[model samples]
Target chain A: MAPTLGKRKRITRDELEQPSRPPSPSSASSESESDSEDVQDIFRRAFEAKFKPLEVDSKKPRVEEVNLELEDQEEEDSDWSGITSDEEEQVQVVEYSHLRHTGDRASKAEQRAFMSSKPPTLSGSTLFKTRPSTKAPADENDLTEASHLKNDVALQRLLRDSHLLSSTSTSGTSTPTLSAVGSQRHKSTDLHLLSLGAKSSIHAQKNMPMSHRIGISAKAKEREERRRAEAKENGVILEKERRAKKFTKERERGVGGPGVGKFRGGTLSLSKKDVRDITSSGGGRGGKGKGKRGRR
Target chain B: MTDETTQTLLKFTGHRHLPSRLLLSTLTGRPIRISQIRPNNVSRQGLQPHEVSFIRLLDSITNGSKIEFGMSGSTLVYRPGLITGSAEGLGASGGVLRHELGRGCEGRGVSWWIIPLCILSSFSKGHMNVIFHGEGCVTGAHPVSGDLSVDSVRTAILPLYKQFGIERDIELRVLKRSCAPSGGKSAGGEVQIVFNHQVRLPKTLHLLNPGRVKRIRGVAYAIGVGGSNNARSIESARGVLNKFVPDTYIFSDVSGAPFIQTPNDKNNPSGKKKGAVGFGLSLVAESSTGCLYSADVASPPEGGTTPEDVGRQCAYQLLEVIQQGGCVSRSAAETVFCLMAMGSEDVGRIAMGRDVIASENTIQLGRDLREFGGAGWGFRDKGEGSEEVVVSVVGRGVGNVGRKAV
Candidate 1:
């Protein structure tokens, strides 16, 4: 026991001097290494002053001390062994992901309701839950819900385009395309656009030549007039003759144009009608001016 | 109108519970004469600044109210008028009555005036939209005066109006935040109350269920301090409250101190100074049946307490309030009881905890209600070995004579 005690004392003395002896040799061997170490020491001290004292200094020294202790133990006690390289290589992973459930905190809607200037209502706790729940469990319920939604959409579309179907049926085509293919599809789309507050039908020819459009409108009027005449001769009560809607054309002007006149190739041109319209005051106007105003 | 003048004045003494007495007087349409208010205190006698500010507010909101004070300011005779809330040409501009508290009113919180005004707004003839701003408007909790923060008043007390059917278009907006100032200082906070719902009579409430606490919500605020203070308080509060209730969430609010315009002096004519700076915690526990319990704590004006202290104190206070086990907490009991007493001519039963019922303020409110010709309250045990009691109050048939014709 006395020899063991002496050996332990000697070993601790050696350990105390061991760190000092190694650093002195390294500093003597390389000046730049010593200088860099001094710089690192300064930074560590400054960091410690601002925030927390660092444990890196103590940890590195303790690791080396532990290695020395293990070496001493290996020489003294042959049966005991320290941690092996395999143990050091193995890593353990700890996870706390499951601890954070979504329900632990207030939802965004709840926050808005409570933090608002208005007094929180009694239903604030269950207000978010009262929203329309689209989530349904069970495969059977899912299938039925899907089919119901599909059928509802189909019925809505059919009801919207049912007038088109009726018009086709009157033309002796009993099978009015419920599938909405070809011409029927265009008619259905036109009806949908009208119901959504579209200004014109989808079949209306845009960017047509002036002569073609005029001829088409004239033919349509001639046909209507012929049918009206036939109905009158037969003494059958016919509907009133529908009139075509007139579109007013306002000429687009350049930003640098004269305010009340047309600009073409750096020239301001004002028609006599335009001048007369500008000069006319409230209800004091002649027949020609009035007719022109009414047309506008 | 002539009969109102001929009615005898209800006589009362002392300045204790003066605000509630004034509220009852306004509500009941009875004149009151209070004498011997702090006559013993020679240096500081008569009404305090906050109390005077409250009286001024009541005077502004009411129409035809006649007020007279004695030479020493110890005696006051008040003839309350109809509650014409924020009417034009009555100290209100642009439909908002702006009541300004002076520098002397730094001790008490702004909620001290707001809570009572809310009760008056319910029975007002017009929509009540008042903006309270001034040097002494402390939106945070008062450590010395025992007044709640404005957050608790909004989240806890104002929610009770729904039970009485006076819940429409009501809002309490905290425009500026300030904590209680130190001695002789000011807190330039701003708060607004918009109570537009006016009814002939509030619905009779029968709330007997003190349900289990489903979740806890809170607001941690820091004014003129670091944002880290709010985080600190929130962490500490959650530390204590999380063990009991798993669904606790505390929101953080940080704002700079409000600047108050001071009188011109020789050195700096454009006098401007920052108001009080502090942090506070306000916790509100909501139950399954819509019952609310609240607790408030703010750092002392002298500034020794930490944010952790305020948070822990608030958390413990909330736990104690919940442990009392009632439909309404102590801070909100006065509003709940007064509104119940002024409700429709029907019996409204509420379950209150034992300690809340036995509080001094509750007892004083009961006596004051009786003095104003309101009915007395009847108490009964809730169940066998339970700490709760069911209080039945019969409301006066005469509710809001201003609104009676409508």
Candidate 2:
């Protein structure tokens, strides 16, 4: 197949070289005698039927002229025959059986692994040295691992916020899947924060007027009382209500104030509790046993 | 505690395998009395300077160790002490122990002390960080005494400790490189070893299979010599090793000669003189199973060989070590066996070449362990017509006494 391809390429090259040959005398001779040319064309057609077709101006006349010129040259050139046969020389095939490195060249990571102060491990210099291999299989593995992590995070988020989805659906939101919209998104975030041990809701107001706070508490208490009374009348069991603990506020004292009472404008004032404590014989805790102290 | 004072000291004669004997005594907390140390040598009898230096090093690391030497220095008694390592106020400053080897210790390489010290460091109570420096520290392989180069110890021996669960923070840093001194010259090499991993008991090792060698890595170091020596050695070594293992790479390290103070010299009392200078090659062949085989060669002290010869000799030596067919090389066998014996009370097995097992040092070590009250080794031929032998050693269960309660 290769030999035939080479021969066809040579024929094409000959066609290209034809115009550069100064319109050789062979073409002129063929035009002068139409009878002989017709005979030659008929023979060529028969030969083309049996085998490969021949060129119109074959290289025989040019080669004869070149041979005559070579024969007239010096005798020293007689021993040398130019243009040997076109058969390709037998390729001197040299096969090496020794193991050869066919992969990428040694990288910097491998150099570091081997040249570091630490002893080079078996897999360090050879197999897994290249930390950023980025090959097909390794890249595929990394992609799958990353996707798995992403999916895991998504699953955890879904489970944690499933109740929010149900509550939003009952409220008649249009897009009621795992995704929350607008206010529902804020509610979802609040719930997530609360689950993560937030002390108070983000929506809780930090400061308000005293009357407004009192009115709000009173209204909430009245609503609870009404619900409980209605539940009792209807003979329906209801969960126990939780009461918020109340904190007592003590009076603030300055750093240099009297121990028992406040000092107001260069005057020291004491309360009845402070006087009873001062009259007692023992210290603060011992003052509880006032009768024993009096007997003593 | 009272009975420890009344315990009889194990008695032995001659100075053969003195380092191993001392190491075992320290590990097992047994006192030993060795007599007749080169008693017949009229010129230089008794313990050599290096031996005395080793004893001094031991004394500095340990506390309350009682040592007694006879008038002639031929008879000696060493009562073992707790392995304290480089504790504060015990010949250590700032957590590092500095030991200076004098000029008399130039006959033996520094590895002669380091290898044994490493074995003891594993069982020490605290971290062992030691810097060995001075005129006698030869970091290269000893051409006459056959001690391994510091590179081989760091690359080959230290890696084996990982199998025993003692791999953390372990490093051997060669601060200055110097070859063995020729004639009366001195070597001013500096080396530091940081072994911060101390274990109550080294994990039992059961290594049997020595897999095929897959790659060869090496370091060709030239000190106070032309850099072309490194290239020449790497070329010749590769010429030999590339035929078998095509994955071979050798790194070249070039450094200038070290300078040390010549204090006692009358001509230049305050001046500094250059130390030994030469080139060397250390080759390590790692097997598929993480086993390592190493070979070391350096320029001889008399200095008549070419770098090519040194490289070719080292490559062939590495091939011979690989052909020995074991999970550990002969140079590291002592450390492996000692750690095995000092492990937990369980049987640990290792496959070694027959020649390695039959070596005199191995036989002497077996004897020394028995004398130190450790269990004897059990040996059997590795099956399937292999020349390797499987050796089984049982631990004494008496690991680091300082860490026993912990």
Candidate 3:
């Protein structure tokens, strides 16, 4: 039990030391190696800040009182062992592919995602760690076995290779697109457009469609909408098209404004049809200035 | 009232119960004289915009109704018309036909004027298809004030009016909504109502136990301001109301151009400087028994009133009204109670009617209105210690004098 305990602690320590997989397994080996240095520092500092204190206070023996005895620990170990291997491999794939996504530098930034979930990886590693004897053979087999499987997938390999090739081909490739995506994510809301008397959502409203479907339905609709908005601004009362656009936008928003109309008292730009509807219904009477009919 | 006391009752101290007295006089064919209107005031004269507009409204509704004001404008003499609407004017649906009929309401007038007009329409000679135009009117008095007031009137008055068999034809349709004190002639409020199917009387609004306020419906309105004003007011109103009724909703009615216009902007057709931007809230609560109680509050254009303040203030006003514990909301209590004072006066009729319910506000208002109108009934309470009083009046049972004696 003591031997296994020492081995387990060593494994947990090793995992704490290294979160990024060996750079060799990833397509961007050199970049991962360079990025790993900073990432490892982050992971180490995080574990020291968050986990070491717990181990000192909890001291595995007291932890057993909470039913996490050796056998339970072994079970927990087995549990984490099974999943962490897979997580490490999948995370490698994701990191490598994304490295391919925004170019060389941003891969370093994601390496900074250690900032986001620094504590998260600490728990994942501690949840399962095996002796070096078991870990080496198993880790190698798991690494090679699963690593080959990613190669067998044409799409992932293509994406990973493409991102690598793109970055190597152009040193100036990623910063702009990456910042744009960042800005899009942080834009808070789009309610500053000065809509009067609109029943807008009080929540963080999502106006743009974030879907990645083939048709880019929202994008096309937006383009169509821009043109119509431009036309409307030019005082073009395209009633048929305006209604359609209003309905579509309203549908997307899950909130609707009082329909298009002149602000009898509100600031609405009414269509001729609305005006006609009122006049047709016998409303245009006595509207020619105030009447003094019954008054002296 | 006999000939002698009527003169004493004709005079009132201030203009508080002016509408009530005017309505009561018109209902019973009683002539009334009032004095000292805003006598102790400065800056503004005897009749504020709403009062003068109301007087003009009364003149339009009743033919030959004579309203004489003293040169100082502190005193008034009112001789009501001998009823003149005919039931034949009510279309097949017991509503006024699609005819062009309405009066004008001025800038200082609020949409609340519809209450008395609704009451009058119910009992007028012909189906009074009167239209009203006002400063807030887009086309006419089309209720652009962004309020739940008209619906509140319907809910509160329907039960009271149901007793008189004048139930079906009470239609109040908003044709246009115009925000007041802005948009000049371009924006105005307009409304048309159909009533007086046969001058059927209302049942006594006796003890219609005000059921628990099931839910509240409201409107948060802002004029010449950004849309956020309505939202902020609604949020703040909900903050206080969350204490008493969790089930409340105040829809926003933010109007005017999204951009503030400078006075000299060419788009400013009215040429008049836009008045201070305004924010207001109107709320109506419907009870379990379908009775409605309502309250309205507005921000003084330059009072530095915040959205939260308007909302909290409106909520407090509503709470004060609901606490009065009567069938009629505090705002409409006087109007309902005055009609109750002139209802079918048979003892059995009174007994069968909703128990003569009156609250502190209603009792006070009824007393003032009746005193000034020089007509009233003997009021009884369920013993002295209790504040609740049951009002009883042998109704004048006014009929249509225009019916050719048929």
Candidate 4:
């Protein structure tokens, strides 16, 4: 009876450890019987996980938490897709692990494909739709916000760390790996805050458009005004000179009439007397004149 | 004015050979041989009338040879009737007969008489009449007078003057007569002829006073020598006349010798010889009427004047007379140089023989005159031993008039 019991337990731990090795004909018959039982267990768990979607949702899947739990177990048998050929072989390997791994292999594969494809596709659509709007606000705010955000050292440090992590992870993987994913999350959060700040600064830029345009327009207007003012001053001076010349010519023409006659006559007499006195003095207006009169 | 009237008178007192040789040579154009006869050493032997006539013929012939009036044709001859028993011929006749008896007398007496007479009479009128006076002689009569054969001499000269167109105003007067005997044996008598004419002054002294007239005439007389033989003599004579008498017209012979004196020696010391008298006749042609007169007494000498001086003074008076007659105008004074021959050989050689030696002597005298300011007026020999000197006469005013004594 013990020999029969040994024959029924054909899926051994060694075979599971080296999955690539082929079984003997006697062991192959017993391993097939055990593979059927393991397959029934994977199908039942896949159905259970599928029906408990609300539970999964309630649990809030921590990708980091899941990756950490799988780290040690996956280290030895990390190649899961490689064990798909023998379900009993994979069941035997998993039985040795402590984590509750209930999903059927086929169902788990489908879930990974679905999860990976959906999140990236959705995220790409989100990036495409927000880029133009976001860029416009940022550029608008940059002039004002760059001055105001001069003291925001936290945001600056976050952007600098993200940039460094992206640079390091980009060098190791084609797609951003687990490490780059964290940096991507941080970059997204920084972008969201920058968008908020950009919107507020954009409002501030819009408020002062009239004052800036007015400053430029004011300079051109001032130059034109100065030119007009100078022309007006010149016109006034020329008009004054013309009036003076006309007065002088009228006096010389001896057309003194009305009030002008007496005024001009008196001025003329005074000027003539001055000229006569100068001439009679013989260019020595004081001493010589006195001497001549005294001698006479 | 015929050639017969133009006579050339030359006097050689002490010398005879040279004159005779010259005369013979001039006449024949050939040389002649003759014995020399000195006037101071003459003999007293008388000559025959015919012989005297022969000698007179010889004298006429010889004298005619010296007559160079520049007249045409040969000399003329004359024959006068002989003198019968005239005392004037006695001396000459006795002298010739004595010479004939002493020397060779191969020719018959008649032939001797006829030949000499014919030859003498042939040249008689043209003969130069030369008169000589010894130391003391009478005033008129002379033994040489008969020997002179005056008719023969006149005959020779008259034709000569007519041929030469020489005027007949020339007069020959006997002022004194004398001669010296041949052989130096007898005292010779003298005969003087006064030859005179109105020497018309050059037309340069028509307005001078009587005193100035005398001075100008004196200058004119001095210029008369050497007038004929050389043209320079006549020119100088005219020059002299022009100086002192600016308006007196001069009428001169072709020879230009004054009728009073020989052409040469008119100013020499020997010119002062006594019995060698000269007189003048004035012939004034006014309105085509010629007036002839003896002008000797018209102007007397100023004081203590000798005959030579008187003659010169009279010559100046004649010049005044001519000027007064209106023959010359006053403008001729400017062209004259008076005293032109005062030291010139033209004046000195006028009466000299035409010999080589005498010509040389005359050339020397001319050079001396040139050395003393040429031949201007008033030149004089200071004395016998002194050199000849010039006496300047400064003329006043324009035209060389009013000459002041300087």
Number of the top TM-score candidate: 2
RMSD of 3: 29.6
Per lDDT, what order, best first? 1, 2, 3, 4
What TM-score applies to chain A of candidate 3?
Answer: 0.15
lDDT of 4 at A211: 77
> DockQ, per-model, please?
0.35, 0.24, 0.01, 0.00
Model 2 has fnat of 0.36
lDDT of 2 by residue, B183-240 (tens): 7789999999888899999999999999899988888899899989988998899889
Worst 10 residues of 2 chain A by lDDT: A1-10
Give fnat (model 3).
0.00
Model 4: residue B136 alpha-carbon error in angstroms: 5.9
State the lDDT at A250 in candidate 1: 71
* lDDT scores in order: 0.84, 0.82, 0.52, 0.29
Query: Could you give candidate 3's per-residue lDDT for residues A1-296 as a string of tens digits?
Result: 01222223323433332353332232223444556556765765776687442222212333323422443466666644222222221221223332111121223333332212111121112222464573455667798988788767645434434544445347664543322233332231222221323365344345645565425766878888998899889987765754344443323322355543534566677577775655654554554435422111
Candidate numbers sorted by DockQ from highest down: 1, 2, 3, 4
Give stretches of model 4 more than 4 Å off. Answer: A1-296, B1-79, B82-131, B135-303, B306-316, B323-406
Between candidates 3 and 4, which one is better according to TM-score? Answer: 3
RMSD to truth, every model: 14.0, 11.7, 29.6, 73.8
* Interface RMSD of the candidates, in order: 2.3, 3.1, 27.6, 99.3
Whichever of 1 and 4 has more DockQ, that candidate is 1
- Model 3, B1-406: lDDT tens per residue? 2443344335555676677678877776667888889887887668775677677767766676778988878888888874544333222134333322222333433335666776776666665666554343322112234333343444344445654555665555544433433332323445565554645455555553556776665666666677787787777777777667765666665655222233575866655443335666777666676556667666653346687887887788777767766455545555555556555554211211122244444555557655544355555543434444444555544433344254
